[model samples]
Target chain A: MTVTLIGGEMLHWSDRPATPALPPVGEITGRTLVAGPHPHDLIASLPAERTTVLLRGLPDAEAVAGLGVTVWAGSLDKVAATPAFDTIVALDGLDRLCSAEAETLDGWDERLAHLLTLLRPGGRLLLRVENLFGVHRLIALPEALGDSEWLVADDRDPHRPAGLAALRERLAVVREYAAYGDALLSREVLADAELSGFVSATIAGALATTGEVLADPAALATRALRHGLALELAPAWVVVTGGAADTPDAVVGAKAVAAADPPRGRTLEDELIAAAQRRDLPAMRALLTAWQKSPAAGVPAAQVIAGSASPAASDLTPLAPAGDPLVALSHFAAAAIRGDIAHLWPAPADEAELTALIAGMTGREVEPADVPPLPSRPAPGAVRELTAERDRLARELAEARAKHEFYEQQIRGRDAELKRVRQINAVLSATAPGKAVLGGLKAGRRAVRAVVKRGRA
Target chain B: MECGVHHANHYYGHSAVLARYCGLDDEAPRIQGYLQHGWNIGDGLAPDHEFVPGVPKFLWSERVRRRAWSLGRRDVYVVGAPWAYLLALEPAAPAEREGTIWYPFHGWEGQHVLGSHDNLIAEIKATEPGPVTVCLYWQEYRDKAVRATYEKAGFRVICHGYRGGWWKDLDPGFLYRQLAELRRHSRVASNRLCSAVFYGTLAGCAPAVYGDPMQLENEKSAFGGQARILREWSDMIGAEVDLETARRVAVAELGADRLLPPAELRRLFGWPAPRSTAAIELTGVLTS
Candidate 1:
């Protein structure tokens, strides 16, 4: 197998001590060729039997002599000429060269189209392009806010004390400059300039086109001229190549070209905004439900809807619990939508419940059929009257029981006392003699008393 | 005899104040007037420990003596946790002394799992002198090892029912007052009793061997008292001894005189008595 790396650091495989050794390829082993502004050591690690080459700066005819190893370099009109190479990695070189080589390069999409022409039928071409809906752009403007020259100059001022007033002045200057500059530049011109530059830098270490320049074409001439001048001021490396004659079957199979290069249709954000503006619950629900299943779909949509001042944001709150992809995505979407606006923000407790619900939602999205109907309200005065009557009855019963227990205890105590008193009376009466018996006893006692007295005297 | 009577009266009065402070109003009167005054109206039983139906004296005098000798005066060193009465006495008495150490052995409820025991051990070592005696009312014998450890560390262990015997004679008011004061005196005392009785008991304070059984035994032994306990307070109004006994017990046991000395009583209870000569002279000098 032969691998070709272009417009990058050399592929010095041998330098990587940690890189695992590749298995032997066929009888001759595999060879690799790297072409870039700087030569790297990765090419040296290839088996001795396998041929290896390093092409740096611009490849000259003498350097390509006798090696049969294809030579490839960055060019606009010469892709067809590089038929000997195994692969071509061109980025907007054609559109850039076709448009009188603007001060800045333009047409990354056209350049990619041109590169495809150079590739052999069934050859692999991997293109890494910036995502149009990437967070980079939104954050990029604010990043540029600090990059204003006035802000830099203010920061450099030695006399100014490091204080909030100075910082505020610098910020104000940056804001003014950005607002004026951004207003002057058309959207198409800015998008094209950004996209062109990004593509060029990725492929040839030069800013060729940008999304901002592509989005606005009216301002394109100025941005293009400025970029062209910059490119003339500083040249960068670019390369292109053709697939080898003996390319592997697997590489051919994996290298299926995209069917169409249509401009990214309404971004997820735009769809969300449109849905929210119309208050189309079904569409909003569909979009959110789709996002819940696949968080990637939800993030952009959430950002767009949350950016606007519509009640749709409130509708999206319920979507937090729809755990399709791991609930993390829903929470992230909710937070991004809510942002920092307190009035617009969901209740924290509700949000917390949403978080837990989202966690529970993980692995599945809530289908419309799953939601239950709302509960019916209870009758108003019935409950109040019932409770009141119950309390009254309970109190009355308790009082009655207490009275009964008191009376019962009193009766028992009195009965025991009466029984004891009766016993005591009987004992006393049994021990006492009658009065008549006492009188009869007194007469007998008198006679005996006289006899006893005479005896005693 | 007059002076002794006067001293006794003063102590009783102070005890009443202490009981009042302790919230043992029932016990306060009994100890203050009845017990201290030795006023036996025949109906006067030993608060709750009534000997017979009418005999208001010690049930088993021999037992009291034996128990007292075994548990009392011989350097009883309470080392578990600080009680209010103990903390109050801590400043007055020598930290190291020989006397009956009466620690309301509530057990390790107050001890922190981390370093509480170690801290207690350190305090005991620092404060106590002579053979340490601990009165354990907790039922768990599994703590025999812990008690044995204390014994090994020169402490003598004495096991008794945590809540029984003379404890029943104690006025709840007095207990509350003493406990509250102890809580105020030392955080350790608050934690000990609170944790032991409240938490540990619920958590099962070392399988009480004698608690329910002892209560049943007491009820069976005192037939009339048992009846009194069963009868409602309203019904027991005519019955001689009722909740009054429990109340009186709380007062007597929790009274200020039982808790503090004459001098401390005068200072703390605000009692009227002959001022000390020094105090009088000092007052006169200040006035002059």
Candidate 2:
């Protein structure tokens, strides 16, 4: 059969990237049933004679039919229950597998349990699960609901696993790779246990490489790395459960899906922040000097790894063009001041002063014009920030008005004082002895001035 | 907007100096906030003057801002002292300065000071190496007895005009006259560690704080007072204090180093932006 739709198949629409969290194509063997929209290249590489692809969207199923594979077009519940598959892939997660026209599973866990049942004994099931608390979601500005989100999945299902620990326990799989950036096209994937500052920095760079974000994701990811929560806060989880086929510790590209040596040491951004927090000036100066002298000085501090030997740029290519060394330093200085990193200067210093101070530590004098402008990104908590600013301005305005009233009251009081002083002066000038005393005082002043003037001459 | 508020903004022509520094013509704009008139231990504003709520207290120093914050005052911004701004505008060239300018502590309008003038005069004669010019406050200078005491002691006595009251005799050149007199003196001394002492220190005069800190009538010790000032500023006290240390103290107290650029100060004070030639011509054409 070319393509079969028993019931509830959506038309025209196809889930993006075709395939996400795909295990290496070489892992596909014998009879297989891929129950989701997968990449065309992946479908073509599979042993199509025995392999079967099931997709909920009619267009996606039709697109895959040309790859010489049997296709099923319908919701997951409509898939034939008779013959179990030797391999199953649902890497798009369970949420998108159902059509709005059909009665769908109530929870993620229930849907995941249903998919696992379709797998034959010893057959592998590759699944991707998104982490709600991931860095990508954490920094995202509140967006309006998309058209596809008609039935917003209530992710608060108590039966569904919440974190990595719960997810592993539910899946009963020891092999899990943390996915970064978009779940549809993960920029980088690494073994959960092997996560380090360098890996997190690379992942952070990748996540921030595209789009106008609410705030810089690189700072958040670097912070997560510092707090030892990188793996827990990974964007998505790709786990392989079942089968004896070996899995790679990391995924680099479509082909280089193999474990690489784990990177060591914290990023220069992390080290600089730490030094600044401790108020260790010498340490900060040394670190700045070494970093500025390095070949990767033009790279952003967050993208460079700070090793004991010297600073080195991480493998992740910077999305922005290489800037002046001073500008890069200025960006780090801005990050230190604006980011969650503790305030750098003991004396209150704004971004420009901090930038100049950082440059000075490296024995380079930077002009104000040379310093990069601070990026004016939309704040993550716009309403709260606006409310705070409103309250501050209100206090300032109230203070200004109060001062105005106080000045008026002062003027009134001083006017009364002036009237009193004038009345006293009038009384003094009106009396005989007062006139004599005033006349004598004037004469004395005249005599004193004459004496000084004669002496000067 | 009122160019001067609380009349103190006009005192010593502080607003005038700030306006000149802001590159504005003599017609100074009303400063957007309450400008700190004197270098006081209090929140920069005179304690007797009722502070209007929420009106910004444009303080002289960070120390004052901190103190004001602790005392439940908000919207305080430190714009340095107007005296410092004046010094920046008219810097003194190298000149043969002579004598010590001694300022006997005087009270504000609300209080009369109590102290022996002869005892201070004796102390000044002993401490100062050259001719002493006893700079008396206008109140003291007006008193025949106080004036005669210094005049008879063979010391020149002078007053730096009135620190204008109620905005009526606002001597705009008050600080200007005081700066010139301070620069003429080899040293500046006051009985108490007061504004004059700090101003002299900043004006490149050797500073001294000695003698009795003459008590004010019912002087409220709301801001630690003279005893606290002595203890806190021990580095700035004595006949021959370290000039470098004294200068540093004066700079911090006056916020001399924190003076904003002309444009920034103009912006902060809500003054008009610098007019471009084209814009000025356009305005002229419209008016004509």
Candidate 3:
């Protein structure tokens, strides 16, 4: 294997530092041109003789060449105009394939078309497109410009696929998988129509491992699944151009590549929230009764599968029971609040009160200890946490100011009352009847004092 | 448990009623939340009264709870009014209840009502078909001149005792006496749409709110004062209200249906459960 330099490639910069989740290496077959930078291990796994890795960075190209695969180091436009490769793998999407050193193709549509043209007749194209309206972006705080955002056309590009459905239509996709996790590290991939209880539990589990997010990604992801918009709200999408293959419906974790079993029914949390949104008290009570009576009562409702008559914890691994059963119920309660589900209470209830009410439905009264320690939860993100704190402080400040003003008014009112009472006393002393009463009161006090003195003597 | 913190919780012996409803008998527990003391157009709280942040506000109804939430209160719960709890504790005996019990809007310390009490008395005489008994706040009842005005109008005048001050002389029987007096009357009427009207409606009395709504000195319209009350509650403001509609509005405004069971109320108030029930709950917990 030789590293060929076609000039115009970046000498220092690599596309992504972390390894991205890719299609199963078993799927990358025939003479393949791996577009953009991929992990070294993934390049080594591919058939070296047939694989031709194209990288925009010289250092990345050299590293791939060391893995016993042909490496073409240059901008994507410099690659031969002839359609040669039987497969084109641009799992990083078409954005990073172009280099600033060469003719920069900023339009997503133009870059995508170029990648498609590079593929030979009867070839396959594996692509990954980041979703603009994804859950990750929805909860993301405003970020400063990064090196990768040199040409921000994704937001303005009309032809660029915006969602899973649009992407399928745009690419004529044979198979599509909803990808969840950080963009570079797609943790879980599931088929578009396979958001079953098992798939959701898997999605939630995968999302929990997300490092720093504005809000709980797990809650938002599960809500998306419950609302039947998981495919649209997925953080990213992986699409393949060609006829469908017999690949697994769900691929969990990029490295291990374990095919998850077929999906089960809806999660307990999902069903309970749906019932709550509809204000179906009887259904909610029944679901709460069933869950509380089950062996998985101590498990978080989001992690349990709501079977017909019973609930089973999705993760079979023996985990420590959430100490208070109310704590277990609070998981779904918090999710419901975060999901903006209509409150079930006839009156407005916060998360703690709602959890207590849920416990009450199961004949349990929640003590102060039973309330979930929600504030101690991993801070959603620095921005949101700070924003909430600032809002709280602002409210407290406004309250304190109001209290100060109230106290001042109270003092003023008291002063006015005292002055009014003094004026009334002055007016009373000026009257004949008032003088007689005052004289009698003075005489009575003198008589009492003399009697007390006589008794002491 | 002793009632302290924001002594208004003990106003009209409100905490005592809630405590009794929670099975505390005569012992008034320190309510874990700020119990809404009076019905107001504001967020269930007296705008002049300061609140501690994060402390729960136990309100009377869903409407007030929503209003309180809009006012930036997050930890608000609807526990119904103390008067409702009192009625639950003391079911009225069947008796020949006669006359209309009238409540004239009154002012508290540092404020005096500025309207014609004689005019209100005349309105009451004209509207009420039967005998009328006017219930006055302690301050007005203490004034012989004010008392004689209502008495001169041929209406029986009475006062429901002092509503306590600071931590001093909190009469636990305040609501009990008010409820008893209300139940003895066939109808309840008020010059303004006040808490007494709602309480009386819930206590099986036909309710009416009309005539001069006396204004307080320096009355602030911070929460859309009397105008908002008249606009929002126009159905309740008539010389003769439909009994069914009055009762329905009373139930919603007072949250009669939102009353908690004794055990749950105890938990919410952070009061200890009675030993027997505690042991039963403990057994249930361990068995489960």
In terms of lDDT, which candidate is strongest? 3
Better of 2 and 3 by TM-score: 2
Candidate 1 is scored at a TM of 0.19
Off by over 4 Å in 2: A1-54, A63-71, A77-91, A98-127, A133-159, A168-457, B1-4, B276-288
Model 2: per-residue Cα lDDT over B186-256, one tens digit each: 89999888899999988889999899888988877877888888889999999999999999899989988
Query: Model 3 compared with the native: what TM-score?
Result: 0.59
* Number of the predicted model whose DockQ against the real structure is largest: 2
Q: In model 1, which runs have C-alpha deviations exceeding 4 angstroms?
A: A1-39, A42-74, A88-105, A131-457, B1-193, B197-204, B207-288
Instruction: Please give the CA lDDT of all the candidate structures.
Output: 0.29, 0.70, 0.71
Model 1: how far residue A16 lies from native, Å: 19
Question: Which of 1 and 2 is the better model by TM-score?
Answer: 2
- Per-residue accuracy of model 2 over A404-449 as CA lDDT, tens digit each: 6766776898799989999999998989999999999999999999
In angstroms, the error of model 2 at A437 is 32
Give lDDT tens digits, candidate 3, residues A96-171. 8888776756678888887778887667888878888888788776767888677774666788877766776777
Docking class of 3: incorrect
Predicted chain B of candidate 1, TM-score versus the true chain B: 0.25
C-alpha lDDT (0 to 100) for residue A172 of candidate 2: 63
